[model samples]
Target: MALPAPNPRAMLADRGYDSDGFRQDLLIHGILPVIPSRKGRSVPQSLNQKAV
Candidate 1:
């Protein structure tokens, strides 16, 4: 059987979905991706410092 259409505003994700390619694919499909960045990758200092 074929998969049903996803909601226009739905979020799609997976643990491996943190890459730029995956995020871009979600944008192309008009869906939001709530995937967090992989660890050890540097993020903005303000964002990370504040968390610490």
Candidate 2:
């Protein structure tokens, strides 16, 4: 059976979830994504470590 989607204020994830599409989806759902950027990315994104 298909499970229901989650409705969370924020999401904590690792670099594996560091994708533009994924981040955008989370924002659209009103969820704050706390995922760090992966290595080898041209522009390194700044992350709030304290929030993790």
Candidate 3:
């Protein structure tokens, strides 16, 4: 199988990929995920859309 590409500086994703585990995985690989928080989350995560 082909190897995965190098880690990107940042990733832009919607709420569908919003999860603690997923974010942790990205950080492990030195990736910055710009995912918005889900509506039901008690503590919402904030992201700067302008920078994306």
TM-score of each: 0.54, 0.71, 0.77
Task: Give per-model CA RMSD.
Answer: 7.2, 3.6, 3.3
Window of ten residues with lowest summed lDDT in model 3 = 2-11
Q: How much is the lDDT of residue 12 in candidate 2?
A: 81
The alpha-carbon lDDT assigned to residue 6 of candidate 1 equals 57
Which has the better TM-score: candidate 1, or candidate 3? 3
lDDT of 1: 0.55
What lDDT does each candidate get?
0.55, 0.80, 0.84
Task: State the lDDT of candidate 1 residue by residue for 9-39, as single tens digits.
Answer: 5454444556767667867987666655667
Pairwise TM-score winner, candidates 1 and 2: 2
Measured by TM-score, how close is model 3 to the native structure? 0.77
User: Distance from true position, residue 44, model 3, in Å?
Assistant: 0.8
| RMSD of candidate 3 to true structure, Å | 3.3
Over 4 Å off, model 2: 1-6, 50-52
Clashes of each: 0, 0, 0
Task: Encode model 2's per-residue lDDT on 1-52: one tens digit a residue.
Answer: 9664576777788899998899899889888888889997788766765653
Candidate 3 residue-wise lDDT at 49: 74
Candidate 3, residue 13: CA error in Å? 0.5
**Higher TM-score: candidate 2 or 3?**
3
